[model samples]
Target: MRAPGDLRADARRNRELIIQTARTVFAEQGPSATMDEIARHAQVGAGTLYRHFPDRDALFHAVLTDALERMIALAETTRKQEGLAWDALSRFVEGCAGLRLDLLISVAGSQATQVATTPEIGEGRARLLKILDQIVSAAHDEGTLRHDVGAGDVMGAVSLLIRGLPTLPTDLSAELKNRALRLVLAGMRTDPAPIPPPVPAMTANDLIRRLSTTGPAKPAT
Candidate 1:
């Protein structure tokens, strides 16, 4: 495939439109969303969609890559602009929630693991984790974050807390997620409570390994 930069202006616009549309459709319909459905939603011809992303996996990979790049940029901006480490961290988490990453990952299911194995995806994840580690360490040094939790723990919590609950209206679901995020943020603050004894802090490496092995949770019967 041609590099995005090499594409004509119209082609580039079409590609972006497809990706954005796919991101939304995938979030709503999961892996079962069809190529025809995506093409119709993107308002692009089947040929155009195929030209950019030959298969569902390719499109999914592109969408995730786009999201990771956006996230990395958001984290960098947050760190630069927010004077207080904790404030930066909180802003970054909120920004992530807005991206609907939890919904994307939940919908991707085992496909996420497959896409994660790609070099681009793996490298993106590593870079994001490195930036997150820096922000987390700063928060720790500032004595604002709980001593017991690590960057991985915070990330894991955000992934869980931001997921949209099934059967809720979009507005209500977003409200609930925001409320949950606020609660999780409060819990992450210093002196929240006595955490259970001896649970090892989750490191970035631990998270990386886990993602490689685990799919999304199975739906309750």
Candidate 2:
């Protein structure tokens, strides 16, 4: 028989494969996709998939976690680039917004309370928010974005746009999204720094929990 530790490692690797495969499926097909499809895509045995992710929502949450990681990475990179605050912040949001599904999850969870708050999701979102706050702050100080738009407010607004990442209406979805981000930035600009929104009570973590629970309902094949 295989050593217990070795067996555990192999199991973890397979579990990761399931998560990776499911993420691709969710991105391509949506959150409601069946486990059967996910298994096929991941090339894992059906039993293996179930062993790793017993519930549909668990698998869905994994996909969202992956997406959040990507968003945080995007924010981290942009914060390093030297540019006009408005320009960098605009680009960052647009780039980050490309991860549409995750953003939508947060928005839905925050407003709808469809998903209860979860710890894992809350941690992932905090990193993304921190990055956004940094970018917005730089822009605000440089007077690139609206001086009135508080960095916190900008982060929240950008999160919404990303959450609603929609299929591009025209042939150029990307171009349109960037343009929209710019408009949002322009609207936020003040001579000093952007102001924040009124207290709504729900934090980004609350929204992430909602997202983790609900996921993107992968549509039927």
Candidate 3:
């Protein structure tokens, strides 16, 4: 495949549009989503979609990469613009929630394991984690965040909370996710109680290592 920079302006636009539309369709319809459906949603021709992605795996890879890049950009922007460390961290988390990353993962199923292990995705994950560690450390220094928690802890919590119930209505699931995030954020704040966490905090590097070893979750028979 040609590098994006090598594509003509119109080709690049079509490629981006197809990837964005596929992200939404896959999140809603899972791995069963068809190339024809993606093309329809993207308002592009079948040939256009194929020309850009060639196949579902290709499209899925592009969508995941795009999401990671967007999250990295959001974190960088939040870090630069927010005056308070807590505010920056919160804003970045909120933006990630909006990206619906859990939904995309749900859609990918076992394919997620393959795509995540790719060198590009691995590099992107590292970059994002590095930025998050900076934000978490800043919050710690400011005394706004609990000293026991690390960037990995924050990411792990958000991942759990943002995963919506597939059976629930979309609006209801989103509402519950928001409420859960609020509770988690509150819990992460320093409390008067001096009780230490049961387990040692996992740093960003630890998280990366753990994820590298993780396989796709087995489906319930």
Candidate 4:
């Protein structure tokens, strides 16, 4: 057997290779592609693949969660920029969306957002949600979006972004992503005038707390 340190190093290397191959395969085939193809392309043995992900869905979940976390990081970084609420959020979302096609495709049919129940997924989710909520509530508070739209509704919007995942070209440009986000954002707008000021950083807990004091924080992006 290998020493623990050696095993850890090997696992990390395998994970990086898997994530890289998954990004490529997912872009080409979406989430339903066979594991054999992934293993073949990555040039790793099936046993090694299984060692990292016990099943197809487990692999898909890992890929998906990793993607959303990247977006969350973008959101946190973008929120500090000074500008109109819509532009800041739009640029961040569009920027992340541009980079997300592969990850989104990997988990497309599975709908397995693995972020909430999985370990280490929270730091990313909380930060991502906080940024998203900040922009969303900011829009409502600033009269950019409708006031009646709830955070659940915003979550539904997030799901729509995923559902539309397969359709979006993996290599989209600044203008195209903007067009797509605009269409989606427009759907959630309402007639109520703005009254509430934008809230602080968004979080899964805070977003869920708004939904119900008792419900689970939404698990996926």
User: Which pairs of residues collide in model 4?
Assistant: 130-202
The TM-score of predicted model 2 comes to 0.63
Question: Model 1 has how many clashing residue pairs?
Answer: 0
Ranking by lDDT: 1, 3, 2, 4
Q: What is the lDDT of residue 186 in candidate 3?
A: 72
Give the per-residue lDDT of model 3 (tens digit) for 1-221. 78888999999999999988887777667777789988999999999989888877788778888988988999999999999888898888778877777544666556766866789988988999999999999999999899998999988876776566555545445655776666677778786233233235556786456545653333311
Higher-lDDT candidate of 2 and 3: 3
Off by over 4 Å in 4: 1-13, 101-127, 149-151, 165-178, 185-221
Q: What is the C-alpha RMSD of each candidate to the true structure, in Å?
A: 9.7, 10.9, 10.1, 13.0
Q: Each model's C-alpha lDDT? A: 0.79, 0.63, 0.78, 0.61
Each model's TM-score, in the order given? 0.82, 0.63, 0.82, 0.58
* Candidate 1 Cα deviation (angstroms), residue 42: 0.9
**How would you encode candidate 2's per-residue C-alpha lDDT over 69-155 as one tens digit per residue?**
777777777777746666667667667666555523532333223322467678888888877777777876776666567757766
Model 3, position 217: C-alpha lDDT score: 35
Error (Å) of candidate 3 at residue 105 is 2.0
